[model samples]
Target: MGTLDEIKAALINLDIPQVQCKIHQGLAEGLSPSAILEKSLIAGMNTIGSRFKEGDFFMPEVLVAAKAMHTGLDILKPLLTAVENRVKGTVAIGTIKGDLHDIGKNLVIMMLEGAGFEVVDLGVDVPPDKFITAIETHHPRVVGLSVLLTSVMPQLQTTIQQLEPYRRELYIVIGGAPITQQYADKIGADGYAPDAASAVDKVRELIARN
Candidate 1:
């Protein structure tokens, strides 16, 4: 495999040490931080995401792969901080109240951070008031809402309504197994991502349009 693909493979196999070594080698070989991130780490996680959706992989596999990806990210994050590498944007994300699942939300965080967006994770079981507070305090370019249960989907609308005062200033994106594009549109959300990989693309596209 090519060096970049090797990074992806290491993450797929959940090989953290290999991921660390490969990422360092990529840097030593003069590859840009963003290139390693987008082409390797994030791309690898995209594969993991597909496997997860297909049931070839489960939560344990995804969690371990996320750890492997982070091993590489830990090494490269400092380089991305260089003045020449300005952050692409900022995001605040969390699961709505009554939903305790956070594995998907954490995956999105790694992917967003890898893609060079400064992400502020609002954690699981977050109330609409907390999301409102996050927007007011962080002044993020986008806010993401995650819901794992269809029963709690109403909280998504409630959270969006609470943030309506800042609607013109920040974009709101939603996701989770229970969240559909139609539901997103129904709630008047600015965007909806089907998975973590697409979340990166969606966030970037939304930011670019504004």
Candidate 2:
């Protein structure tokens, strides 16, 4: 198999040490870091995310694969200088207020970073004011909210309400277990992703439109 394919397989296997070594070897062989990320790390995570959504891969499998991806990213991070690391756009993400769940949020952050966007993760149980502060401070092209609990859907609404003034220029995306496209639309979210893989695609689409 090709180097990229080997890297992808290693990532799926959650072989962190091997994945890191292969990424280094690929870089030495003149493979671009961007290519390695897109073809191997992102590709593998996409597969894992899809499997997870389809119930073919459980949380443990996805978590391990994500860990392996982080290992490879550690090796590539230094090679990506400030200018090279400046991707298509910046995205700020957080789990909405009063909701502490973060696994889904973390997965989306990883996928976004893998897709080349600089991500600012605001962590879980974030309030509307925090989102507003982050948007004002970071000036990101897009913002993402994650809410796993049905109880926290109102928090998503509050965040969107707080962001409506800047909604014309800022793209807002929402996701998590209880969030649906209908709920996203109802809450005035620009986009909704059912899973991490789809979140990558949705963010790309949002950036393209912007």
Candidate 3:
């Protein structure tokens, strides 16, 4: 297999050391940082997300793979310095009020950053006004809402509804263990991601549509 393929495999296996090493190899071989990101790190994370959706991979494996992706990203990031800060697009993300879970939020942020989007993190327990403030401040192309609790689901809807004034101005994407496409549709969100890898995909799609 090729060095790029090796990079992808090391990431899927969650081999942090190998991932970093392969990234170095890719750079030495003259592979562009964007090529390394799309072909290796994002590609591997996409497979992990598919497995998680199919119930073949669990949270521990997903988190480990995320770590491996970060290892590779740490190497590629500096090389990508010129375009690293949102040449792709900007996204404002946060966990809704009363929901403190961030593992899912953090994973998505990692993937977004790796994909070359500048993320304005709103942090956890964020209110609707904070969302609006971020929208006004960053003028992000997408706004992401993460909800980990079934009870806090209403807050997600409230946040979305409260942002109706900005609906025409930006796209909204929602994700978390408790979040689903159905819930997203019901709450009038623009997109839904089932896993961290797909979160990047979803944002890409949103950017295209926007």
Candidate 4:
């Protein structure tokens, strides 16, 4: 197989050593850092997301693959000085208040970064004011809120209400264990994603309209 394809397969197989080796090999063979990242590493992660969605892979597999992707990214970081210029857009994401679960939120962040967006991780148990502060500071084109509990679902609506003033220029997307399109629509969210891969796609789609 080609060098990029080999790198992608190694990542999908969670072969961290092979991923690093291939990254170095790809670079030696005149491949650009950005090419290895977008074509191999990110493509492999996207496949992992699909496998998880299809039940062909689980958390352990996904996490290991993510680790391999990170290893590849670390190796490429120094050579990818111009990565900021390749950013599609900025997205600010946080888990809603009263919800400490960040597994899903973290996965979304990884996917966004892999998709070449500058992600501002707002972290867990984020209150509405914190999100407001982030909007003021980052001025991202899209905002994502995550909630893993049905009880904390109302916080999503509350946060969206607090962000209404910026609604004209910003798109709000919601997701998590208990979040659904119906809930998103009820809360007036601009978009909803069921998984990390979809979140990247949703954010990309939203950014295009901005």
The candidate that achieves the highest TM-score relative to the unseen native structure: 1
For model 1, the local distance difference test gives 0.89
Q: Go through the candidates in order and give the clash count of each.
A: 0, 0, 0, 0
lDDT, candidate 3, 105-192, per-residue tens: 9878977887778899999999999999999999999999999899999998889889999989799999998877887898789999
At residue 191, give the lDDT of candidate 4: 98
- Can you write out model 1's per-residue Cα lDDT over 1-210, one digit (the tens) per residue? 788988889899988888999988888888888888888988888898889889999989988987887778788877877733788888999999999999889888987887779999999999988988888898999999999998999988988999999988899999998888999999999999988889999999999996
lDDT of 2 by residue, 27-140 (tens): 889998878877998888888777878999998888898789878877776565443656868899999899898987887887677667889999988988898898889889
lDDT against the true structure, per candidate, is 0.89, 0.85, 0.87, 0.87
Better of 1 and 2 by lDDT: 1
| Model 1: pairs clashing at backbone N, Cα or C within 3 Å | none
TM-score of each model, in listed order: 0.92, 0.84, 0.84, 0.80
Error of 4 at 186 (Å): 2.9
RMSD of each: 1.7, 2.5, 2.7, 2.9
Better of 2 and 3 by lDDT: 3
Estimate candidate 2's alpha-carbon lDDT, on a 0 to 1 scale: 0.85
Q: Work out candidate 4's RMSD over C-alphas.
A: 2.9
Model 3 scores a C-alpha lDDT of 0.87
